[model samples]
Target: MAEVDTEINGYIVPKNSQIFVNKWTIGRDSNIWSNPDSFDPERFLKREIDIRGQGFDLIPSGSGKRMCPGFPLATRMVPLMVETMIHNFNWKPKKGMKPEEVDVSEKFGVALQKAVPLKAIPIKL
Candidate 1:
């Protein structure tokens, strides 16, 4: 229980602080991430770090015992969905668009989402 206590305290705001600091903001801080605004998945692959909501460096879901249980389910589902899609077909952008031009801008809410829904051509192979 002590281990859990310490971890929770590490993330908690000071009692007297008036400002509300969102954990998500800290996780995605520009100072912490190089080219933070860029959607560089490679940066994560190059490092041994993970963003399963722990390790402080990345906590998209959160950290510690209170961390989201749905995280594990998401971890499994996301790659599976991507794999299923890729295995079934080929992906490409529109005639005039490049993959890089495929707008990746995000909108935040209870769940994060792309500002514009992704437009892709999935060719049945």
Candidate 2:
């Protein structure tokens, strides 16, 4: 909720109005991202960007006072979990499925998820 009436880009925003920031769209804006539609993790390799909300471009966990309290926990746990999974098992797509044939479409809801459930076989190492 807005604390006071404010004007954004010449438009008057009434006081106490709820404002929803579409972070997803912001992330995909071509002006803000290079090759926005493509999945490129390496883009950040040479850049210094903050994910804890300081960097306006990427705030997956959000930023500022309203940011997710679990950010710290997630930062540590998520990587550890991924490392453990990679170390313990060898993963492959379901038999007969080629890696390049996997569907990467997104299903938007409370959070964006794969449009089709990813089915893979994990063999214990």
Best by TM-score: 2
Give the poorly placed runs of model 1, Cα more than 4 Å off. 1-21, 111-125
- Tell me the whole-model lDDT of each prediction, alpha carbons only: 0.74, 0.86
Q: Give the TM-score of candidate 2.
A: 0.78
Judged by lDDT against the true structure, how good is candidate 1?
0.74
The ten-residue window of minimal lDDT in model 2 covers: 104-113
Q: Which pairs clash in model 2?
A: none
Write one digit per residue (lDDT tens) for candidate 1, span 57-91.
77777776657889879999999999999999998
Best candidate, lDDT-wise? 2
Q: Candidate 2 at residue 31, lDDT?
A: 86
TM agreement with the true structure for every prediction: 0.62, 0.78
Q: Which TM-score value belongs to model 1?
A: 0.62
- Which whole-number lDDT from 0 to 100 does residue 49 have in model 1? 77
